[model samples]
Target: METDRQGLFRLPFKLPSSAKARSVGVYIAGALYAIGAWSFFDAAIYSRKANASSVHVTFVDWIPFICSTLGMIVVNSIEKNRLIQDAMGSGSFSGSSSMAWQARVILFLGFALLAGGISGSIVVLILKFLVKDFTSYPTLGMGVNNVVGNFCIALSCVVLWIAQNVEDEYSYSLTL
Candidate 1:
């Protein structure tokens, strides 16, 4: 009777069929980190060429860079966790499945684009307020782009946190 009962319970909730789904978040986080790191390097190079770069890094750049790096670390850690491996031993989160991962990739890209747009608009507003001669240089556009990219990156870190939590909840629910 005990064995029969155990089988009955197992019928409704078996191990996840695959581990493939949970990787969506990992991949998205990895890509964001890569892009942010590349941009940081690019900015450093450009600043060197201009010779106008500040010897002291401003709060703006430093904060976002740190946050993005942390986000990358989190993603890597999640990928390495044993629970995740066990869960996938049955099946992965429905959301992390191959189709779901693809959807997530699209969603991440959309977020990136949205963040870029918002950041660009903000930088333009700042320039309009601070620069008396706004139309003087072509480089102002580049400056604006940089500011916006950083803003987007920082914001994405917050989004990533929320997303990780959501994924955890979703994974738990699937197990039940």
Candidate 2:
């Protein structure tokens, strides 16, 4: 005899099965990146055309966004399989410790740039706008947008990394 047991209710979530469905993460990541980029660009446009305040989005503001973008590119350009193979100690390219070390260093640089971009945006927000008397919403919003945009870009990078395995779907690795 079997008894019907009352259990905790769970939300229904149908997992996607197709490879195309899996790639949706990439699309989402791209959309996030686009939104971030558009936000920053909009800030610049406002500064150029609509801003009443003397403060404007300058090259300093662009620096963080550029760094973040470059970091994203670098981070995603690496092959995750190389790192995995090196750690496992078996693969066609795993024989050379220097290769693994190089990969690690490059990956570290990429992450460092990403972190630096976010921090730099915050620093700009504080030192440039907040510290000054530009407390008005319009002027302050520029700095705030920069910070938000960089953050979104970083988030997009994370999403993209997860979606594409740091963006290398097919790693060229040969096992021995």
Candidate 3:
């Protein structure tokens, strides 16, 4: 049987898949998430304090961000071993199957929330800001920030996932 392939792309440069790289990826992901959160916060503040237009950031504008943050937390908290072993059909414990099932369910929910957040952000931009004739950059920025913030959050999740998977594979390589 042919073995399964690994890594999305083979790079010309050999990047060390070390623990340090994993740590850096995690830190970068966190920073991206923070930037996303701050972007939304800045938008809310600008709307509250300096916005001359009637358009202001409201609770409706915050739902997407909340969902994204919660999703990130859920996605990052799952133990990777469970997911991998489950797929590989290696169960040492009686409850391993159930644990894997739970992990899958939770993981699915997390991804759903993440996707929903991105979609919701776009919806808010179009329905709440654009439709209301908030054409000027200053006023429109509120919605734009929401979309950008959610996108950054999604990117953060991707970085974290790649980092985690790479770390696991690195460990496997060492064992072999």
Best by lDDT: 3
lDDT of 3 by residue, 1-176 (tens): 84444333465665546888889988999999999999999999999999998888989999999999889888877766666555554433334577777887898899999999999999999998889887899889889999999999989998897677664344643343
Better of 2 and 3 by lDDT: 3
**Error of model 1, residue 91, in angstroms:** 29
Check candidate 3 and list the clashing pairs. none
Clashes (candidate 2)? 0
Per-residue accuracy of model 1 over 30-148 as CA lDDT, tens digit each = 56645655655565455456534233123453444554444434432332232233334455444345544554454455445545445544554364423645442333433444454
Global CA lDDT of candidate 2, please? 0.80
Q: What ordering of candidates by TM-score runs from best to worst?
A: 3, 2, 1
Q: Give the C-alpha miss distance for residue 119 in model 1, angstroms.
A: 9.1
Give the distance in Å from residue 81's predicted Cα in candidate 1 to where it truly belongs: 15
Q: After superposition, how far is residue 168 of candidate 3 from its true place, in Å?
A: 6.2
Measured with C-alpha atoms, the lDDT of residue 161 in candidate 1 is 40
What TM-score, to 2 decimals, does candidate 3 have?
0.82
Question: Which ten contiguous residues of candidate 3 have the minimum total lDDT?
Answer: 86-95
TM-score of each: 0.39, 0.80, 0.82
Better model by TM-score: candidate 1 vs candidate 3: 3
